[model samples]
Structures are given as structure tokens and as C-alpha cells.
Target: MTTNSKYNFKWEDLGDIRLGRPNLGTNTHVAVYRLMQYTMRDVLEKQLGPDKTNLFFIDAGFKAGVEFCKNILDCTLGFDDFGANLADKLLEFGIGVLRFEKADLEKMSFLLTVGEDLDCSGLPYSGVAFCDYDEGFIAGIMHQYTNLNFEVKEIDCWGTGDRTCRFAVELAKS
Candidate 1:
């Protein structure tokens, strides 16, 4: 909300939201966070429809992921170290636990699980996958880290009655 800058949004712009609430630093109830996300999603769906709303969310998450990688991750690490560091950082920030089921560097394909994800960890079954934003986030991080494009898709979600969110990641074909 400061002066319009020449550059895109940066992480520092998220200046400690707990500025005055030292007692509640970086700890908000999941219900409140879900309320904010779901309410905004409800409004976006009402105005833009489901498809467009999903796109908007994915776009937003993509930007966030790019910024997060630039600010928080070391992009120079090799494949194994990269994933391990990412997992550690995600856990440190309480984003989730990352478990790679498969990682084929030659094929640029990966299968992973996000346990207790912020997006849809405990949500009631909605019959559809609810991790489009997460897909974009994963793709963005991978793109920034590897300087390559990837297709990251969420195949299972808590919203789809899955205990953990499972995502399939593959290099995008040219």
C-alpha cells in the first residue's frame, strides 16, 4: 500500500503483520486463515466463476512462490540438496512436510506428498481437487530454482478425501 514501486511485489512488503501484536507473532488459528481464504474464494467464484477464480488463485500463488524462492531459498543447490532445503524451509515456516516419493532427474519427473498442507489438510470432501494454487506454487519454485518449466498437478487432496495432497511434477514439453 506504499508508493507504487517500479519493481514487482517483494517479500519485505509483507512487513511483520504482527507489528503491534507481539503476542501473536506468526501464529494464527487455521480457522481464521481458512475463513479468509474461503471467503475470498467465495466472492471470486461469485464474480469471476470457478474457473477464472482458480486461475486467479494460481497466478497469485505463482507470484508468491517465485518471490519466496528468490528471497528464502538457495537456487544453486543440486537436486537432492535443493529438495531437502526446500523441505526444511517449508517445515520451518509451517507450510507443510514435503516427501518426495519419486525423483527422476533425467526425466525431470517427480511425485511428492505434502502432509498437513495449509491449503486443504482437513477440509471436508468437496469431490474435486483443491490445490491449483499449490500446483502453481510448486511450478514456480521449480522454475525459479532450475530455470526450467514444469507442469505440477495435484492429483489427490484432502478435499478429495485424501489424507495427504499428492502432486505430480514433470518437465513441460517444448
Candidate 2:
């Protein structure tokens, strides 16, 4: 896919939320967020089909994750500290509760879980994992942190009858 020369996203594009919504602030109902997400998915699926639509969401989420890491996270810390900071930031932003279930620093692989995920925490079982965006999001964050490509896959999700979203992250085989 070719990059859009006309418009490229940057962290500054988010603008000053505090100035924009003085009273309401940055918080919004989860239902409102889910409405936008689900509606966008529906429209994209209709136009592009499921696989391509999933790719688009993953790509968009990757971009968002890269920018979020650059703008919101401290990248200079050690791995454990960085993970802690990431978890804290996720919670602070009301995104989710992040935890590392397993980590192999030698292999650069991890099993991470997100509880109350912004994407699919309470979703009913649909016999499929529905956190493609989150998969890319984690990969993007790891890319920024380690300066290496990663393959991130969601093996379990609320959509798959799991209470939390679980991802398997590993270095991308080049």
C-alpha cells in the first residue's frame, strides 16, 4: 500500500483536549467509544471485506501506538520499568489493565493480557478473536521500544469467551 502524501497523522493532530473541552475533559462513555469503533468496523467491512478491513484497523492502530509511545511514554527506561510505566499509563487513560503473564527476554517473546480492554472487554462470545487493532498496537509499541519488528497475535479475547484479551508477542521472523 502506498502512503497518503496528502495527509499524514502526527501526535499533534490530536490537539489540546483540555482546551477544547474545558468542562467535559478527556473522559467519555465507553459505549460512545464502542459505538464509533463498531460502526467504523461495519462500514469498513462492507466496503473492503473482512480481511482487508482488519488490516486497515491494524495499520491505523499501529500508527496510533507509535505516536502514543513517542508522545505519552518514557522510552528511556529499562524493560521492567517501561512495562510498569506502560501499564500505569493504560490505566490512567482508562484504556485497560495490562499485565505480563510471561516474558522471555532472551527470545524477546511475551504473553500479555489486557483486562477490561477498551476494544473487547465485555463483548459476548463470537467464536473468534476480535482484537486485531490491539495486536498491531502491541507490536507498534514494542517496535518503538525495542526498535525491532514484532509479530503480535491475540490468541484469546472476550469475543472468544475469554475474560481478558491475551496476546502472544514475539520478534518478527525476517
Number of the top-ranking candidate, with lDDT as the measure: 2
Candidate 1, superposed: residue stretches over 4 Å from native = 3-7, 17-20
Give the clashing residue pairs of candidate 1, or none. none
**Each prediction's TM-score versus the true structure:** 0.92, 0.96
Give RMSD to native, each candidate.
Answer: 1.9, 2.6
Model 1: per-residue Cα lDDT over 39-104, one tens digit each: 999999999999999998888788888988999998989989989999999899888899999999
**lDDT by residue (tens digit), candidate 2, 9-47:** 877777899999999999999999889989999999999
Supply the global lDDT for candidate 2. 0.92
Worst 10 residues of 2 by lDDT: 1-10
